[model samples]
Target: MRVAKQFTPEVLLSAPRRGPAVPSPDGSLILYTQSAHSFDDNKTLKEVRLMAVESGASEQLADDDKVHDAQWIPGTRTDIIYLKSGDKGTTQIWIADGADPAKDHYVAAEYDAPISALKVKALADGSVAFVVAGLVGPDGGLFNDKTDEKKSTGRIFDDYHVRVWNELYKAQKYALWYSTLINAHGKWGVAGELQNAIRGTTLEAPYGMYDVADPGDSFDISEKGITFIAEDTAPSSPEYSGISHVYYVPLTSFTAAPTVRPRAIVMGISETKAFYANVRFSPDGSKIAFLHSSYDSPSDVRLYMGHTSSFGAYDVHRMIFGKRPRLPPKAFEFAGDSDSLLITTEDCGRVKLSHLELRHDAEATSLVESGVVTAFYPLQEGNYERLLVTSNNIVDSSLWQIVDVSMTTQARVISSATKHGAKYGLSHGMVSEFWYEGVNDAVVHSFIIKPSNFDETKKYPWILLPHGGPVSSWLDSWSTRWNMALWAQQGYVLVAPNIAGSTGYGVDFTARIYRQWGGAPYQDLVNLMEYLKPLPYLDHSRAIVAGASYGGYMVSWMFGQDMIKKFACAIWHDGIFNLPVFMLQSDATGGGPEFGGAPFLWSNGEEMEKWNPARPELLRNWKHAPPTLIIHSEKDYRCPITEGLAAFNTLQAQGVKSRFLTFSDECHWVLNPENSMIWHQTVFEWVEKHIGGKEARNF
Candidate 1:
């Protein structure tokens, strides 16, 4: 028998990651993108594949080099549409046969600007209406090429949207443009000029201004009309505040703009500023549903649904359950009945799939219990009785299954992870979970990942990985950025704690981190380290801790207090080192709310200073700092590069060992495959140098 090789960063990067699967019109086949890094070429390879849903067989449908965002052409079985990148760096639409994609032909005029997020639907007039998102000039046209050729290199922003997560606001804004495919003289091509759905307005289609991934479903199109979430362009509204609304644009003709202006169908409530996302219209165009969250209660995202009308007015309300599910939903899809939904919610470290009814006192029934359901799509074959569910766990990266709508644990495996696991020598038994009482007697949960070659009698150095989202939980899912299993394979025990601020535990637990960033959650980490110190299998003295984003913020906070003494070394990436500076210079507007109101607003800078790690008192203790690795990106506007530089300088001045690693082309996270390899290698070397673990040569 062939021995399974050890899992390495190279193997991890080479592993194929699947995108959201799109089902065919008849629900007999699935179309999805599989992407992986080519170490030899040092670039990502993407392939569009077609799969037989019933048999679980798949084949490549398009050239990976040039094709992307492929979708079934609404009403046809073999007909499909996708975007193709040209040699000149322009992206255009192409139509192809699912069986013979080699004969694909371009269907529309290529625009100067690139487009993405393709949505296709069949209109009533035997024509195909397609919508794509792309940047449009200030004049609401395709693109303003003159801005690219301007002699002066300057950007004048008089308002809040000077910069977002990684890039500055340009002359163009993202808008949804639509056109129809017409068969003229038996040759398929676009009918007329693309009509801008949000034309004559300052609104942007995608409501993304803060984080990397755009907030929610920016827009969805149906046979009747198009529904989209737009950024509130009112002078009073701030992009960082995440003020957005859902608007409905009725369909007139694909060749012309909407006869009537887009109007708000869903608005925020009185007290809290609302952020909307995942705006999905029901399979039948008669109804709509989406995920809703607010500034005050960002973690308590709930599902809201309403019926659509011809007059363009709709009453969308939050579905209040008699016995609410303890977990807040992440994403949801409407059932064929249009009155029910299949929602994936984070629950106690695992994402559960639940069935929700849309009545007065409805409750979500838990369907799938094991593994995290990352995405799910309802099949039209059984009147939406069956669903295509894609999930993963700590050990397994990818698994696709077909599950019925009923409450059952059984599912037919369509894509198994057995081969992938064996290839990398991964085992499910390596993962386990434990809980302990934390601050205020609140229960804190954590996942423990052990090395594949288990030896319980031997002591292993442990790595404490705090997740990024101070508001997010470390779910039981696979992640390329920070793969726990891969980390554990480096001859160490990996302990990922879901502390007070983490979701999936409860709303109260999640909200505890608010205004008390360094209080409950910090104590929870301290208590956790203390609890783990007594365990026989762990080398408590050689403990190493690392995190990114909010996790990095916590590491910075730990350096300020007695908690820094617990770990041998630390790694902080894109963390907020100085709260006052972060509030003023960060891309986010009014960055103070997460810190409990703006400095000039509610508390007059008191709230921002209360938990700041860079406060004068905290910096005095930097003399005893541990060996540290600081990683920040130049393009990161969220935490900004200044935060990293300031922290590193303080450590250096205090005679503490520290190093700074940064990527100019990357953002808040190191997404480039080569950069990621360097990141993993550097982190491992840092840990091995101080805590004594697997050497970089062995890795």
Candidate 2:
């Protein structure tokens, strides 16, 4: 009577994946980061540790492979700073000091000045400035292969370039630079000679950039300078109008040569186009917080809160807008004595916690409700402002809890770190979450997992899934990918739902699936398969359903619907199947907002035509088209690989039964570990030869 284990993807690659954690403003050291999979360098291996939030003890600091911008050093307690690599692979910023890891150094004394994301602050007099985000070539080395082959001999990308996920856009911009920390008297040195300050002129070589494009956890630090979020692209205004403004620069004029120009101050109203992001700034620097998003809306995000020492004379208010969806704007921050702010989004399918107040402009309340959040902070401990969480649910994986809310609302688990993950000597599997109703009655939110040898008088077999940000959800998270506990150890019973455009359900249920792509979350997955046929344990004729990228555009819009006979088969990684050919090979930019951008038709792009599932009269509503499997990769430029070759040439010209795989050096996610064990052994051998699973692939 005791067997609970089996979940797979090789038990989510044997578990070692913790978070960005950081802590220590004198809260007794935390600094985290971990990773593990190394098999003779078939990669994963990254370290950077240092626990001890009061003796849960841990040490090892940096195996040097992505300590994803570690931090701390703000009024120290064992310094930290991170980001390594140097000579040629460029990125440097180093710093160590857990009381002498041989007193480490390198903030940039030269050595190909490439740097990337560093932000530190301290200074009221005892100095310590840092503020990075780098790149400098023609010998300062931005990956010098002779300055990347003499700046590509002639590279010229004009017409407003912006590529996404395929990477690099205008030499991937990234500017601002500075350094000061160097303290020879107390020990620990190097960081100083770097003061380029945005530019001294490479003559705008590779199109301007001073901020607002990645230095993610976007900018801040203000004793009167450095505020970030850029894009004015000056050529006489109105060039790349994805708006963005909030700029500033003053830290006592950065101590040395001609480094000033950076003043703008949170703009956007070029007659209502707008767009901005995460900004921050309130820890006594006098108030700020950001995220605006508006380009002609389908629920455009808002949340403002202003006053920034009146830099642009903003008085501002709108504490939140149209319906949530905007946290992780650099993990938000500020509770306690800044009077509440901390957030963490995606609410409903979980990953919750909220705060707001900021002297009560009200709205934004919920404070931690159930799991999936992958990291958090805002801890004043003792007199308690607590909330240092890190979540995980659906058969728990990440743990580090603690909610506390000062004189009340507690929550515990201080560290469940490394509890020997990955084992399934059989039994565990049961997640569930339910609630139905959709299309205007809304309420949605679904999920179910079941199978650890369950038996509520048997019925079983199910799959469904959907998520992929048709605005993202179906998260109660823990993943190697789409894992409802590794697909309920194969004895099926999965389902996901959160439909009607998803994203923690709000900006009009996530912009109503952008252009109603396949309308109302495919009729909320056919009213959750007619309410999972009276859930007496869900069998739905041994169902099947799979997804990826808009759930592979809803399994190629469920092969043009009639609910594709409630799925007897279907999967579609990297999918968009066709909405004007994914808005013309999308890297985002599909014309018409009266040239303001992202507009194309009727009050809603290309005029929603009964939700174009690439309409050719929706294949005469496909009499019965389920059987399919089309995964794809070969460097997916956001939904390319010609959307799994046009959903495998329309299920082989509608003769239906399909299969197409592909991977050729992956992208758009298939994170190699033997290409994710051959993508979960080709979707569990095409769900055990067509969805009636028997669990024989020895996991």
Each model's number of backbone clashes? 1, 9
- Specify the highest-lDDT model's number: 1
Reference-based lDDT, each prediction: 0.77, 0.63
Q: How well is each residue in 1-699 modelled by candidate 1, as lDDT tens digits? A: 243477888878777788766677778888888888888988787888888887777888764577877877766666778888665447777777775656646555676667777777777788988888777875667773433676777888777777778877766677888988876664558888888998877788866633456433577877878888887655464524567777778877888878877877643356436677888877778766667777667777766665677323222223355355456778777766677777777888999988877777667777777778877776553256778888888877878877878745578778754453565787888889999888989899999999989799999888898888778889888888899988888888999999978988777788888787878888899889778877899988888889888888888888888878878988888988987767677776544336666544344567777888899899988777789999999999888999999989999999999999999899887888899898888988887898865455465
Query: Which run of 10 residues does model 1 get worst, by summed lDDT?
Result: 310-319
Candidate 2 local Cα displacement, residue 250, angstroms? 12
Candidate 2 lDDT at 89 equals 51
- Predicted structure 1: lDDT: 0.77
TM-scores for every predicted model? 0.93, 0.32
Model 2, 410-518: lDDT tens digits are 6766675434222343222377678888776777888787776778898877888888856567777666666676677667778788887676766666766655667
Task: Return the TM-score for candidate 2, rounded to 2 decimals.
Answer: 0.32
